[model samples]
Target: MSLLLQIETATTSCSVALAKDGVVLGFKQINQRNIHAEVITLFVEELLVSAGLKYDELDAIAVSSGPGSYTGLRIGISTAKGLCFALDKPLIAIETLEAMVYGIINADQSAISADTLLCPMIDARRMEVFTAVFSAGGTKIKPTAAEIIDANSFADLLEINKILFFGDGAEKCREVLGAHRNASFLPDFVNSAVHLTQKALEKFRNKEFEDVAYFEPYYLKDFIAGKKAV
Candidate 1:
């Protein structure tokens, strides 16, 4: 059994899941910002107990390395790295936006047959988002961005077919990008531990693991700390 523990704290969601062979066995999650640090470990404990497994039994650990909240990503990656060190397991670092796209593709394989593109967006504040373009085949047509999307952020991609937009940041792009004839919205898509777990397992088998000590969240943009007058 390829038992993997997955963690996703890229946005407001705090999630942890346990999976074996790409099948989710247990998951726990919350959609509140600023709680990942406090709740993630607890959720992990709960998930393990629920799955009738021990922490030492995990074969590997996976974490959503981000294009989302700066603080959230730090907390998640730190925790994941710590666990990997303590448990002596490989660390699978999955991209935050890419993981969201995988969730969409896994959810509906049929959506792509009609030429629908999956665009996963994570809010980056002040009208910006951490986003990327993914084709139905799970290829990254566009790399992740820290873009202040407007009427033409993805004009080229939108021209091909209707794009399915989701994640916490998706709704905010409506007034700007939603006017396009080829833009569509899926309101309830949020990152989940279950999706993270499955994606991690696949990555592990493909030797996609990263160095635990050096792995860091993909905070697409530089985290600009606010300055105060001296």
Candidate 2:
């Protein structure tokens, strides 16, 4: 049986999960900003204890590789990498937006249709988002990109296909795209480590592991630190 420890801090949610054979055993997460560093490892430790598994017992460590928060991504990827090195386990990296697509599918399968497109967004600077489009079946329909939203954003796609816009970045887009008849939103979606399970399992079976010493978070855009008031 394959056992994986998944970590996700690519957004406000700081989450961790343990999965056995592609099924999520359990997860712990808190959807509040700026607390990832303090709680991530603690969450991981608690999870393994709860599941009665040791760090070495884990077949792999999976982390959400992101187009999300710069700080959050660093915290998550660094933690996963540290564990991989220490435990001598292979690391699996899953795209943040892709895992999110699975999250909504698992939660709201009945509401989605084969024709509807899924767009997962991670908030970036004012009006911009790290986003991508996917089919409900989890196929990537569009490559991930950092986009500035406007009334015309996704206008062409909305004309033919219905879309479900969600994640931390969806709210800012509501006023811009929500007016369209074909557009819908999943109001309370939050990133979770459990979302990484499905893809992690796939990558594990395929032996798609990353070079532990060289892997880095996909920050989509360069990070700019804010200067404090003088």
Clash number for each model: 0, 0
Q: Write down the TM-score of every candidate.
A: 0.94, 0.98
Model number with the top lDDT? 2
RMSD of each: 1.9, 0.8
Q: State the lDDT at 99 in candidate 2.
A: 95
lDDT of 2 at 218: 95
Q: Tens digits of per-residue lDDT for model 1 on 10-106?
A: 8899999888988888889999979999999999999999888899999999998988889999998998999999999999988888888888878
Give the 10-residue window scoring lowest on summed lDDT in candidate 1.
Answer: 108-117
Q: Which ten residues in a row have the lowest lDDT in candidate 2?
A: 48-57
Candidate 2 lDDT (Cα, 0 to 1): 0.93
lDDT accuracy of residue 17 in candidate 1:
85
lDDT of each: 0.86, 0.93
